[model samples]
Target: MGRPCALREKEVERVFSTPTIQQINSDYAEFFNLVGNNTGVDLSENGFRDITTVVDFLYIQVSYRIYYPPLPDWTTEGNVKCNNNPIIPCKDKTVYEIMKEMNDLRFYVMYNSTELHKLDGGSVLTDIGKKFGEYVAGNRSVTYNIYSAHDSTVSAVLTALQISDAKQPEYTATVMVELHKSAGDAQGHEVKVFYKPITDNSSIEEKNLPGCPSPCKLEDFLQYVKRFEISDWDKECGNNVPTTPAPPSTDSLGLTHQEKITIIACSTVVVVFCLILLIMFVRKRSSRSMAPYLSLGTGA
Candidate 1:
């Protein structure tokens, strides 16, 4: 006798007809249609159905594989898959790995091109629609308002901006945001963004200078939809004008020659002091042992 099939035709049909499954399928179809229409990509209903099924399966498989423990309880002698493998398991996985996995899954499906995979036009319609909406009204423009943060944040921001690929140390994301407005009404609109990292005490001092304003607060960014304001041609807004300061002989923090010399001298003194103490301790111990041996020889 052959083994029975896991799902019969009627049973499969019944599962698909369930309310939860039906709602998910409807949502998936709508998402596919939206992306395809917005990006001007063509996709068929069958293709959409197939892609949806594949994505759903991948999500389930990955989630289960990554989170399911070999042993559910100590009482059970044999190793077995988790009975209720939740999408997110708090005890089994680290928060960072979970976040990374989620991000990878999202980016992969969201950015996959239909042409490359011979997917129907509807495959990337949802993502394209999201991108379009974001480009038009979202805060895609970089903001330089963070003045204090971890180095990882700085590295991430730099990566996003196509700056240096160097990994920053912790707490280096402190940066200032500068916004530049468009030149004239005829030119439509444009904004220039600038970010400066604040790493040391000197950077903090520069931030507290007389004229330079602090980075806009998070609340300010949230409240103000537009970070840049239109420059009035009549009044001097100083948007286009370059305000150059006198060139310093040293670095921007104005560290004078004397200050540099003093710092170097202090460092040398501290090092020499430690060396002298170490030598004195060693010599004193050596001299005591030699004197005792000399006395013993004379007595003998």
Candidate 2:
């Protein structure tokens, strides 16, 4: 597997919590809406008041499919066929079609929510591409840069790389990045990048970096990857902004009760500080004047 490339925490993972059923429903409802906006799935079906209702219905439908395990392309989303279901009359709502909506909903949730780049609507790609460049440049000395992360991490990285063609990654699915250097001819040396989806098969020829021919040259790949590297990542990220608070509100001349109290307290401190400073300034001036007279031998 390629090194786990993580720059920002997945926003979905942060927002998706399992604290309570209400919280889960609320989160899922928002997620469904976001997905619906993209997929144009009519989530308001069958007496559904809100997106939460659709989510609840989906859960129930999924549960029913799991329990009965419907028959002959009639039961589940992936296997179900609308026309030739021998067991039940569900041409209108054959399994996969309904499931595909849910699937599409889920896909759009991950697809839209994730950040693209810290530089420009992107973040993970910036880091991942830089890391790939580093690896290709023979800079990293570590054995394994591990990514003990969620499915969102995998999805986010893929989306950032502009590579996510398939559905979300399965559990423990590894995306291997193979950077190979060839010594076919004495005239020139070449390097290519290959990405393999999580699979048991040994063959990785199908997952070639698109547009670039297989066994692509090193210089060419470097030039291609350089686009993802931002000129100033820190500036682009806005990381150096100080945490200094906004100045107190000055909307009204007459202060409210709380504001009155705050202003009074502040005025007291300001007066005290100014008085102390004035006293010091006067004493310093007096001392300077006194010094000249004292130098005249205490007025003879």
Candidate 3:
């Protein structure tokens, strides 16, 4: 591991000029830390691991709601509207105008489910143990099966692994698998798997760890991440992703010649004012020094 660098306040300010981006990045790190703490898992340990491979997936679940009319009327008008806009339409009736709405509903369900999964997955003890094993294996340069995923992803992995307890509430768990090898022992290898419950406010707290590598604020992290994502997209999509041009500035706002002249004149006036003040300050100090000398000469 490289030596950690400490960033001063001014350095942080210089790196992250924009407040919003700084806030977002801070929040993101905080969220990650919180998840780690709640689960009693230290993801930072994994940070030290030589991460050779990364796999990502989503876990999914379906929910249902019963459709009922206001007056319990099953007549054609009521039935048509109900069929057309049922509170919860059947899988087949979800078509045409309702398709967009259904898609939106499904998206929301997936998002919420994923969030819940992350929360639960973070706190599970079994998951943390498996993660630690993976970390050890990675550090030892062993070809180990390691997995890190969100809640939905965990559920899906568990289901795929044919783990019996893969249901909600009772079977909720953070699924993990790992392989490890002993240092300097080519043939010494170990494989492990486990699951744990998701909990809130889980995180591993670090004391005396090296500070941030650079004087990076939240904005700096955002810009770094953004550039990374854009570069990745460019590599993946080739020519499909068009490069965006920089936006026009104040100079490109179609200002008239006279307005431009006025702005320049105003800036010149401010500069002149500052120079005048500086000159006056120098003169005042000179006069004050001379006053004492003149008084001493007259008294003598």
Backbone clashes in each candidate structure, one number apiece?
15, 8, 17
Worst 10 residues of 1 by lDDT: 114-123
The model with the greatest lDDT is: 2
- Better TM-score candidate (1, 3): 3
Taking all chains together, each candidate's TM-score versus the true structure is 0.19, 0.42, 0.22
What candidate 2 gets wrong by more than 4 Å, as runs, is 1-97, 104-125, 128-140, 185-205, 230-300
> Each candidate: what lDDT?
0.37, 0.48, 0.35
Error of 2 at 123 (Å): 4.3
User: How close to the true structure is residue 128 of candidate 3, measured as C-alpha lDDT?
Assistant: 37
Off by over 4 Å in 1: 1-149, 169-172, 199-300
lDDT of 2: 0.48
Comparison by TM-score, 2 against 3, better one: 2
| Best by the TM-score measure | 2
TM-score of 3: 0.22
| 1-300 per-residue lDDT for model 1 (tens digits) | 011222222333443455643443444454335334544444334322234333333344443565553322221222222222243222354323332333333323222232211121121222222333344365576432223433333443333223322322223334333333335544233322243444444543223211223342322332232212223321322223456787647757788777889899999999999999999999999998888443445553
